[model samples]
Target: MNWRRLWAVMLKEVRQLRRDRITLAMIIGIPVLQLVLFGYAINLNLRGLDAAIADQAGSAGSRALVMDMLATDVIVPVREARTPQELMALLKRGEISVGIAIPADFERRRIDGRAVAQVLVDGTDTVVQSAALQLAQVPLDTTPSANAGPLRDAGLSAAQRISVVSFYNPERRSAVNIVPGLIGIILTMTMVMFTSVAIVRERERGNMELLIATPLSRSELMVGKVLPYALIGLVQTTLVLLLGIWLFQVPIRGSLLDVYLASILLIVANLTMGLLISTKARSQFQSMQMTFFVFLPSILLSGFMFPFAGMPKIVQWLAELLPLTHFLRLIRGVMLRGAGLFELWPEVLALVVFTVAMMALAILRFRKRLD
Candidate 1:
């Protein structure tokens, strides 16, 4: 090997790298972005999880119990329900994280010492389950102390007071949570990969001129490109769900129609996103690079692998921009919590907005003339 020749080749490669601005940016940007995300944006310790209180007793004792729990900061109070059933419904709809149900017989129940105030936790998310379980272990000895609070005045003291009920995946099975999310993950990867290269492949194969000669409107062309993959996306959805159910024994407690409705919405959004990326990318490789740029954050910030509540407030805001975040909530709500479409309207609306915005961007950016 000639040492000079090796040096010359290495220098030439470095110069070529500097010339490709996009690649150069990616080389520097990917590492920095990952550092920021993993270092600051992500968190394992949960705080401010949305929660609700069902004070059936509506007494000072109930209020004190709520205040004491709120003081723990394990959860944040969001809604107030009239009954335990209403609180459970809110949980089923994926509206809140913790549900504190203080029974009408709050003081009387503690006399025998089994479960005084029932606390229901949505166990679909193991992170949340672990965090909210702190309430159950809220120092049983404190209840029997001589504190002059009204709650103590009510004589609500017991060895076991808060009966924490883990709803949904009672056993805290990771598969139950992961399976529904896998549907979104699979669709995101395949649909985006399939269509991101569509336009680039056309240009690569010398089909751009043929497409240009056609009289098809940009909207028509964009729709035509995305619709085929939308069907494929649904097909992929069915396959993943079937495998998840059969292999992992993940239960579908909610209506299957609601699951399909979520799948369809997510499918279109992902397809349109790919089309949008396809319009921007000049090559298949670059399109995939961009897809990966979108993909990494989608998985980390989207609450697929980590708890959404665990992210910083700004990170949570950013996660909301990704369609996968909303899709996970929708699919998980229906499959694990037995929730209906109407109950999960916020996610549905977010997906609708993302789909329309992506399709419109793709159509607007798409041009007949070759670059």
Candidate 2:
């Protein structure tokens, strides 16, 4: 080394970086975005989990336990179940994360010094399940001396306990949860990457100029490019579902039709997003880079691997914006919870809005590029 030559080369590179505005912005913006996502949005503290209560005892003791559990703020009762079966159904449907069943003899047992309550938890997400189990124990661990009101009147002692029952992968099998979510993750990765390079490849090959000279409308061109990938996405979804069922033994507890319909919407949403990336990217390499940017957030922030509720409020909001986040919920809700359109309409509607918005933006950007 020549010190002056190294300085001149470094200055030249900096000037080139300044000229490539998009890449420069990405270099600066992506790091900031990742820092914010990791530092502020990601959290493991579980709170405000949806809970269902089945108060068969209907006694003051049972009611006090419920209140104490609610006070913990770990789980909040969203619905009341009249029977144990109803509570289980709620758990199976993913409608509630935790279920409390106060036995009909709960009060009598408490008075007799043998009180026992059952807490049923959805164990699919191990992190949430672990937090929930600890939180559910709070009320049970309350000694008669510690409880001031009806709980003390019930003759409850430290012997009174809440037995936890894990439901949906009771063993906390990661496959049962991950396999279902893998369907969406696989679809997102393939669908977005496959289509992201479509238009940019055309431009790279110099075909874009010829196509633009034709009378084809932007919408027509976009549809023509995206339809093939949409079909490919559906085929990929079917193959993945079969593999998951056969290889992982992941049960499809819900209607296959519901899963297919939601999968289609998810596919279209991602495909449109790819189209939007293609519109912005001037080269195939840039398109792939942009797709990876989208892909990372889809995988990390979508609650596919992490508990959605574990993420902070702002991160949750950002997660909600990703199509994969909603799709994961839809797929898991249908496959594990047997959720119907009524339970899933919100996610479906979100996918619809995302698809339309991405398509509109892609078209607008394409036209601007043409002009």
Candidate 3:
């Protein structure tokens, strides 16, 4: 186990990884390009969802109630129909998420002090259906008398009822909530994938020997190799952020600097972890297989789509170790809650520790394997 031999191998590997275009693209170009496409533009929230209205009563009071439903941020009224049959067809065809019905005797019954209105929602989509149900009944919450029947409108004023507000994802907009999460996932996947490719490429081509023959120390070589990939990660982060602001109108409520700094730190940890995996893999195929193994757990356990609280306690606790979970917290806190440096220090520190540990392990493995 000669120290000089290890230093020589590390230097040559760094040079080869730097010169290879495939490695360069993986480390520098892919992460940025993907971050731009997947993180900034995609949305999961259901907003301004389509809705159909049936007005059998054709009364002024019924019309007013329909307007109130439309006024809420949840539903977008697409068309007015005369029959319930026409509205049902729209729902089956996937043209709308919900429909509202006013009975034929709505006006007459209301004037006579008897009133009833029905709202039909597609149960298939829990998110959209829930939004529709909440907004539709908000009016009812205000005037119990107003909803009792249309004829009774003369005595009750809806103006005095308490206002309802949305939590977590307000404005019922999907892009705002999803962009932050998309950023975290995209960064982790891209950074790890690229770094894995670089390490495996060296093993496949037998050029690692040429690197081991050089004078560069193992630590110096590792730093040099990681720096270029780190730059690429920064580029990707910038593109995603720019696109999110321009295309999706997602606000960066927190310090843009904090988001970038935290993201860079997170990317470094992801790349180092990838490097560690590559150190042990016998071939590129094995490296990729290992990547899938890591990716699935990180994504599912990371709480990108599934709520962390809803999962069993064990699953939630396991997810805490993945970099994605803490990164999501930082991204969402900054993007949605406008959190600052003070709020995000803990996540940044965790990322730093993870990166240092992974890089050290990869370096140690490389030294032992070469000896």
lDDT tens readout by residue for model 2, 1-371? 99999999999999988987777878987898789777776677888888888888886667888888788888888887999899887876677888888899875556445546777888778887787777445645334433433344344433236677787677787888998888789889988898889888887787878897889998999988888888898898899888988888888878999989888998999999999998888777778788878988888899986678777777788889999998887888888767785677788889999999999998888862443
Best by TM-score: 1
TM-score of each: 0.93, 0.86, 0.57
How many angstroms is residue 183 displaced in model 1 relative to the true structure, after the best TM-score fit? 0.5
Position 253, candidate 3: lDDT: 69
Q: What are the Cα lDDT values of the candidates?
A: 0.86, 0.81, 0.67
- Ten residues in sequence with the least summed lDDT for candidate 1: 150-159
Off by over 4 Å in 1: 140-159
User: What tens-digit string does per-residue lDDT give for candidate 1 at 1-371?
Assistant: 99999999999999988987668879998999899999998888998999988888876666777787888888898887888889988899888989988888765554445476777899999999899877876654335324333234333433257877899988888999999999999988888888899988999999989999999999988899988888888888899889998999999998998899899999899889999999998888889889988889998999998889988899999999999999999999999988898999999999999999999999999999887
Ten-residue stretch with the least lDDT total in model 3: 157-166
Clashing pairs in 3: 8-211, 8-212, 8-214, 9-211, 9-212, 12-211, 13-211, 32-236, 110-151
RMSD of each: 3.0, 3.8, 15.6
Cα lDDT tens digits for candidate 3, 178-255: 677777778788888877767668756876787778887878777777888888888888888889889988887678
Q: Any runs in candidate 3 off by more than 4 Å, and if so which?
A: 1-164, 368-371
